[model samples]
Target: MALPEGKMDVNLSNTAVVLTDPQNDFLREDGVAWKLVEESVKENNTIENLEKLLKAAKAQKMKCFISPHYYYPYDHDWKFAAPLEEMMHSGGMYDRKGPLTMEEFRESGADFLNVLKPYIEDGETVIASPHKIYGPENNDLILQLRKHGIQRVILAGMSANLCLESHMREFLEQGFEVAVVTDATAAAKLPDMDAYAAAMINFRMIANAMWTTEEAIEKIASS
Candidate 1:
């Protein structure tokens, strides 16, 4: 669907793909976030669709920004950890246990780095926004986008109702054209999907358009 008040039909010619928290903690079958959006994660072929989208974006020579979730060693800071702590204990997405600390979890799962290594090696712009809160975190996302002269952003990643929504709102506030790829974004889980859908509906009503991965790919290809 078209963005409610914002412009439709963005010029992908200079658009950037801003992947939000596509980490093992979010995408892997054993991921905490996966448990939340397992159905959509599976049904939407989230990983596969993201790969396709990434490939298409690369083929078009679009800019790419990766926003990976990372938590420093300290007390609880993530917003969703309270109830999750009692319910899932250390099994939740933000919880750390065993030999792997939260920082380690982030480092190991930042495979997107490897995926985009070639581009970086080739002198392409690769922005990394780490330890970012929903959207208000003092990350380098905005600065990187401005440095690259990027105006349009294609968002994809986990927890559609949280991280994705936060980034979308921030981007919109910054006056950037934003597009959320539904197939690439997954909610926390079933009942949560309802919330996710509602948030997307609200997002569509204000910030930017929400399109399926296939539609996003087609638009990118056409552009």
Candidate 2:
């Protein structure tokens, strides 16, 4: 059966740049996922590409939202976890090491990259309440976007197969039009699987559109 037709043109007035897990724990060299994702991130020039996308979005006055991953001390109390979730907790991937309202989490290795900080710290870019792990269910992202009257999302950010993909799935199901910036996200490479490769296949299959940063920037500018 043919899928129902949908519009691809993004209406800037109702569009927001929604990024997932743009933290140092995923982008920086010292991050836990670095060794596994270094090649893919470098190959795609993820950081520079994302910077360009962010700058363009700001210039175009497009609202931006960040769906961050944070694990507070209490999260360790969860009784059961999936393999990856268990690994994340064990490795302290995004652990905050402090209370939820404390600023200590911002000082940790899980903070957003320095280059992206200026854009994010500004009053315009809204940082949604941190997602407990990966998806929007545990976060206030959808609420934040809806409050801003957003209906479309220009999506990007870390761990293509994990957080980024999780964000994409939820956003799509929530009746939001989503465009995935393909090069703006990267993924870990495990011993038995190439996560980035896996993500690309799904990205193309599921997202309304899979865009390069340049393509997305151009579209946003034209809009």
Candidate 3:
């Protein structure tokens, strides 16, 4: 099926790839949140698709922004913890634990995937200051994007219904044209909930457009 017209003819020069929570804590097998989303990731071929998107964006010389999820010792002091926030702490998801120590964050299961390291480590990719919570409001992401003259964002990453959706909503509200790469993201499947399915409904209803990694790559090439 064809996607909406104007949205796919994106201006890569003014566009940025806003990848939310692409760290090992969400993507690697040994990471804390892996168990919850592993099946979905594999089923959706998310890792490979994300690689294609990132690499393609790099090839196009498009700006890239990474919105990583990180939890500090101070975060544990939040007066009110949402259900997911509580779960994140209880399970040590993205937990840095100590303020001065980043051992955990730099270690095996918390770093960017090996396949994605080159693109992220290229020095051109803007690793936006980690989001203290779930969205860009708590981070420097928007400022970084704005500084780079980014007017549109191509979003993709882990936990489809949570961080990805949160980033998309915030980006849209901030007046940035946003497109979600559907196959580049996956979501947790809990006992009674399907996060991916839920996120898909919202994406279709809210995002300017939703594209598969292949379609996004093709669009970028044409642009």
Best by lDDT: 2
Report lDDT (Cα) of residue 202, candidate 1: 63
Global CA lDDT computed for model 3: 0.85
Q: Candidate 1 at residue 188, lDDT? A: 61
Model 1: how far is 7 from its true place, Å? 4.6
Across 1-223, the per-residue lDDT of candidate 3 in tens digits comes to 7545435457877877878888888898888889999989999899999899998988889888888777777778789988878888888777775646667567645578878888998999999777866778988899999888988888999879988999999998999888999999999998999999999989988898899999899888777
- Look at candidate 2 and give me any clashing residue pairs: none
lDDT of 1: 0.68
On the 0 to 100 scale, the lDDT of residue 89 in model 1 is 37
What lDDT score goes with residue 63 in model 3? 87
lDDT of 3 at 83: 85
- Give the C-alpha lDDT of model 2: 0.86
Clashing pairs in 1: 36-188, 36-189, 37-188
Question: Using alpha carbons, what is the TM-score of model 1?
Answer: 0.78
Measured with C-alpha atoms, the lDDT of residue 25 in candidate 3 is 80
| Cα lDDT for residue 67, candidate 1 | 72
For candidate 2, the TM-score is 0.93
